[model samples]
Target chain A: MEENDVKNRFKAVVIGGSAGSLSVLFEVFPALNPRLNVAIILVLHRKYSGDSSLSDLLSTKTSLPTKEIDDKDPILPGHIYLAPADYHSLIEKNYSFSLDVSEKINFSRPSLDVTFESAADTFGPSLVAILLSGSNDDGTAGLKTVKEAGGFIIAQKPETAQMPYMPQNAINNLEIDLILDSKEISDFINMLNQ
Target chain B: MIEDEEIDLLLNDVFEIYGYDFANYSRASLKRRIIRLFALDKFPSFAELRYRVRTEEDYLKRFIEEITVNVTEMFRDPSFYKVLRTEILPVLGTKPFIRIWHAGCSTGEEVFSMAILLQEANLLKKSLLYATDLNPSVLEKVRKGIFPLNQMKQYSESYIASGGTKDFSTYYTANYGQAKLNEDLSEKIIISTHNLVSDSSFNEFDLILCRNVLIYFDKDLQERALKLFDESLGVLGYLALGSKETLKFSTIQARYKQLDKEKIWKKTM
Candidate 1:
C-alpha cells in the first residue's frame, strides 16, 4: 500500500518500547503534527511505581496533549496517552482504556504485548503498531498480532536502536511494514498527518 | 458493535436472574469481558450468550468468574506490605482488639499475606481478619488456604522484600504441587461473601485493604465504595489502596490523609 493510503487508513497508533525509548520518543513527538486526527498510545517499562513524570516530560517535547491514562478514560483523537506505571493498560472495544494489575508478563507490567494485542483487537486494520528500542523481546508477539490483523507494523531499525533485542525480534518474527530510525520515524509520523 | 440497549437489557436480565448487579460497573471493562466471553465460548452473538446466561444454571457460575478480573499475588506490592509492617502495625498494636478487613480478597493470597504479617507482628492472638469477596467460589478457596506450589518462590521473594524475618517456607507445607498454608493461621480468619456494590458494611474495621479492586469500578461506583469504606472504618483507621488508585478525586477525599508512599491512608474524620 502507498504511504498516503496507509496514512488515511489509520485510526490509532500504538508505540511500545522499554530502555532507550525516551530519547526516541523525544525525537519523534516533536516532528508529528499537533492536530493529527489519531489517538497515540504509549507503553514504556519502568522499574518503580508512581512515576507519572513521563507524560509531563513528553508534553514538553510535543504539541499533542499528553496525559497518564486513568482507568476507563476515553480515547480521543489528537491526544497522546501513556500507560501509567505498574498497570497493564488494555484498549477496550468501546475505545476506552481498562487498567489491569495482573501478574507481570515478560517481567514487566504495562506490558508492550498486552497493549498492542488489545489495540489490534480494537482497531484492527485501522491501527498502526510501532516497536521501538528496548532490551527485551516484549513487542514481538504483539507486533505479530497487529500484522495478522492487517494493521501497519513498524520496527525501529536494529542497528539504529540503542537496545535492539525488542525491534530485532519483531523484524525476525513478523512481516514488518517499515524499519526506520528515530529521525525517519519522526518523518513517517509527520507524513501521516499530511 | 453491540448496542447500548442490548447491553442494558442483558445486564438487567443478569441482575434479575442471578442477583448479581453489574449495572454500575465501568461499561468499557464490562463490555470487553462480555465480548471476550462471547469469543471464548464461541457464541455467535450477545443475544445467544444472553439466552444461555438466563437459562443455563451452570453457565452463570463460569460466566461470573470470567467477568471478574482476579489478578492478585501474595504480597503483590511489597512496598505496601512493607509499610504495614514498619509503620502501620506498630500503631495498630496499641488497640485492645484489632479488626482488619480484606475486601474483595480474591483467592486469599493477600489475605494470607496479611495473616502472615499479623502473626509476625505478634498481633494475631488479639487480631481478627475478615476476608470477604463477591464470588462464593473464591471465598471457598480462601477458606482452604492452599496455593499453587510454583508461586511459593515468588511469594518468598516478596515476603523477604516486605521485611519477613522468618523463613517463608515455614508458613506453608508443599505436597502434590500445592502448598497448604499452616492451619494455625486460619484460626483467627473468617471468610465470607460480601458485595461492595449491593451489600452494606457489616462491621467497623481498624484496617481495610481493598487494593486493585476499585480500578474496575466507574467513578460513581468508586465513590460509593469509598463511602462504604469510610463508614466501615473507625476514626483513625487505615485504608490501603492499590498502587495506581487514589482517593484524591473521590467525594470523601478530605476524610483521609496519606500515611505513606505505599497508598496507606488514615481516616481522620
Candidate 2:
C-alpha cells in the first residue's frame, strides 16, 4: 500500500507513550507536517491529576491547537487532545471523548489499551496508532487491537527509545507496519498528510 | 460484538417497554459499556442480548446497571474535595439547614465523602445529603454504606490529600474485606431513584454537585440538566460540575460566578 495515499484515509491518529516519550514528542511536534488534518491524541503515563502545566508545556512544542480532554468533548481534526490524569479516557463513536474512573490497567490510568481499543471501535481502518517509548507494556495490546481492526500501527525503533520496553513489546508480539526513530517519526506522520 | 443499529434497537425497546430513557446518553460511552456487558455475559450474538433484555425481567436490571458506569471511589479527585471543604462548604454552613443534592451519585462514594466533610465540620447532623441515581441497586449500597476494603488505602491517601484530619479508618468498620461506613454518616443521607432525563426538581438546594454525570448526556440533555440545576438552586447557591465540564456555555452561565479555584460556580441571583 502506498503510504502517501493517506488523504481521507484516516480520521484520527492516536499516539501512546511513556517515560522518554516527552522528548520524542518535543522532537516530532516542532516540524510536524501541517497537511495532516486529523485528531492527534496522546496518552502518557504521569502522576499529577489535571495538570494544566503539561498542556502549556506541550503546546509550545507544536503549532496545533491542544486541549485537555473533558468527557463528551468532540474529537476534531488537526487538533491535539491530551488525556487527563487519573481517569481512563475512552473515545466515543460520535467523535467525542468520555472518561471512566475504573481501576487502573497495568498500574496506570488513561491506559493505552482502553483508548486504542475504543478508537478501533470508532475509527477502524482510518485509525493510525503509534506506540512510543515506555517502561511498561500498556500499548502493545492496544496496538494489536488496532491491527485486528485494520488500522495502521507504528512503533518507535527500540534503540532510539529511552525506555524501549513498550514499543519493543509491540514489535516483538504484533506485526508492526512501520518502525521509526524520533527523527524519522515526524517525517512519517507528516507524510500521512499527503 | 454488538452492531450500532442493534444498540439503537435495544435502547428503544428498553425505553418503550420499561419506560427507561437512555436514548439521549452520549452514544460513545453508552455503546462501549454495552459492548463490555455483552462480552462479560458471553452472549454470542446481538439477538440473544436483545431477547434476554426483552424477555427476562431480572436481566433488565443487570443490563441497566452495566450500561451506567458505577466505578467510583471516595475522594476520587481529592483536590476537588479540598475546595469543597475550604471554599464551598464553609459558606453553606451558615444556612439553618444545608441541603445538598448529589445528582447521579453512583455507588454513593462522593456522598459519603461529603458526609465525612460535614461531620468533620461539625455539621453532619444538620445537613441533608440527598443522594440519587437512576439505578436502585447502587442506592441500596449507599443505604448499606459498604465498600470494598482493599480500596481504603487509596481512599485514605485521597482523604488526607483532601485535608481530612482524623484517622480515615475511623469513618468505617471492616469485616470480610468489606468496610461498612459509619451509620452517623449514612444517617444524614436520603437515597432515592431520580432520572435526570424524566425527573423534575423536587427541592431547592444550597450546593448541587453533579460531577461527571452530565458527561454521559448529549448536548440537549446536558442543557436540560443544567436548567434543572438552575431551577433547583437558591440565590447564592453553589453549582459544581466535573473538573472538565463547564457551566460557561450553558444559558445559566451569566448568573453564576465561577469560584477562583475548582469548577464550582455561585449563583448570584
Candidate 3:
C-alpha cells in the first residue's frame, strides 16, 4: 500500500510517554495544526495531583481542544484528550473513552501499555501511535502491539530526547516505522493536516 | 484478546445460568477484563473458560469479582471531601437524622472516610451508613475495616487535606502490618450485597454516592441506574458521583442542580 493511503486511514493519534516527556510535548503541542482531524490521546505518567491542570497547561500551548479525559467521553476528531491521574484511560470500539481505577501497570496509573493495547484492539489499522521521550520502557510493548495490529508506529530520536531510555528501548527492540526528532515529528503531524 | 461474539456469549451465560444481569454493562470494559482474566488464568481456549464458568461455582465468584473494578482509597480527591466537610455536611447536620447510601461501595474506603466525617460532626449516632456492593467478599473487608499499614501515610495526608482536624492516627491501631479502624466508626455501617443492575431500592436516602461505578455501564444502563437512585433519593436529597461523572446525560438531570463545579447535585424538585 502507498504511504499516503496509510496516512489517510488514521483515525486517532495516541501518544504515550513519561518522565521527561513534558519538554517534547511542549514543542510538539505548540506546532500541532488546528485543522488536523485526528484525536490526540495523551497517556503521560505523573504524580496524582488532585487538580486537572496539565490539560489546561497544554491547552495554552495549542489551539486544538485539550482537556483531561472523563469517563464515557466521546472521541471527537481534532480534540486532544489527556489521561486523568490515578486512572487508566481506554479506547472503545464505538469511538469513545472508558476509564478504570484498577491496579496500575508498570507503577503508573495511566499505563501506556493498557491504553495502547486497548487502542490497538479498538482502532486496529486506523490507529497511529507515537512513543515519546521517557525514562522507562513502558511504551515499548504497547508500540509492539500497535504494530502487530497493522497500525503505524513512530518513536522520538533517542539522541535528541530529554530522556533517551524510552525511545532508545523501542528502537533497540521494535522495527519503528519512523524515528524522528522533535521538528520532524511536528512536521509529520502537520503533514496529516493536509 | 477476545472478540465481541465471545463477550456476548459470556454475558448471556452469566445471566441465564447465574441470574446476574450484566448485559447492560459497557462492552469495552467487559472485553478488557475478560481478556485479562483469560490470559492470567491461562485458559487454553474460550470454550474452556465458558465450561468452567458454567459448571464451577467457585470460578463464578472470581469472575464476578474481576468484572467489578474494586480500586478505592480513603479521602480520594481531597478537595471533593473538603467541600463535603464544609458545605454538604453542614446542611445534612441540620436534619433530624441522616441516611447516606454508598452504592457499589468496594472495600469501603470512602465509607470509612464519610463515617469519620459524621463522627467529627457529632452526628454518627443518628446517621446510618449503608455500604452495599455486588461482591460478598469485598463487603467482608468493609466490615473488618482493616487496611494496609503503609497506605495510612497517604491516607493521613489525604485526611489532613480534606480538612480533618484530629490526628488521623487516632482512628486506627496499627498491628500485624494492618491498621484496624476503631469499632465506633463501623458501628453505624450496615453492609449488604446489592446488585445495582437489577436490585430495587429498599429505602429512601438523603445522600446517594455511586462514584465511578456507573462508568462501567453502557449509556442506557447509566440512565437506568441514575433513575433508580432518583427513586431512592428524597425530594431534597443530594447525589454524588465520581469526579469526572455527571448528571448532564441522565433523565434525572432536570431536577438536579449542580453544587459549584463539583460532581455533586442537589435534587431541587
Q: Write down the lDDT of every candidate, Cα atoms only.
A: 0.87, 0.89, 0.90
Docking class of predicted structure 2: medium
Q: Tens digits of per-residue lDDT for model 1 on A1-194?
A: 56669557888999999999888998899888878888899999987544577788889998888999977778998999999888889877779887887668799988998888888878999898999999997999889888888889999998988998889988888788999999988777766776
For lDDT, the strongest prediction is: 3
* Cα error of candidate 1 at position B115, Å: 0.9
Candidate 2: deviation at residue A127, Å?
Answer: 2.2
Evaluate residue B35 in candidate 1 and report its C-alpha lDDT on the 0 to 100 scale.
67
Show the lowest summed lDDT stretch of 10 residues, model 3 chain B. Answer: B24-33
* Clash totals for all candidate models: 0, 0, 0
Q: In model 3, which runs have C-alpha deviations exceeding 4 angstroms?
A: A1-3
Candidate 1 chain B: worst 10 consecutive residues by lDDT?
B26-35
Cα lDDT tens digits, model 1, B142-246, are 889999999999899989988997899999999999999999899999999999999998999999999989888877888999999999999999999887678
State every prediction's TM-score relative to the real structure: 0.84, 0.95, 0.97
Give lDDT tens digits, candidate 2, residues B1-269.
56789989999999988999998887767887897789899998889999999999899999999899888889978899999889877888888899999999989999999999999998898999999999999999998999999999999999999999889999989999999998889888998999999999999999999988887888789999999999999999999998878886789899999988688999998
**TM-scores for chain B, listed for all candidates:** 0.96, 0.98, 0.98
* Residue B188 displacement in candidate 1 (angstroms): 1.2
Native contact fraction (fnat) of model 1: 0.38
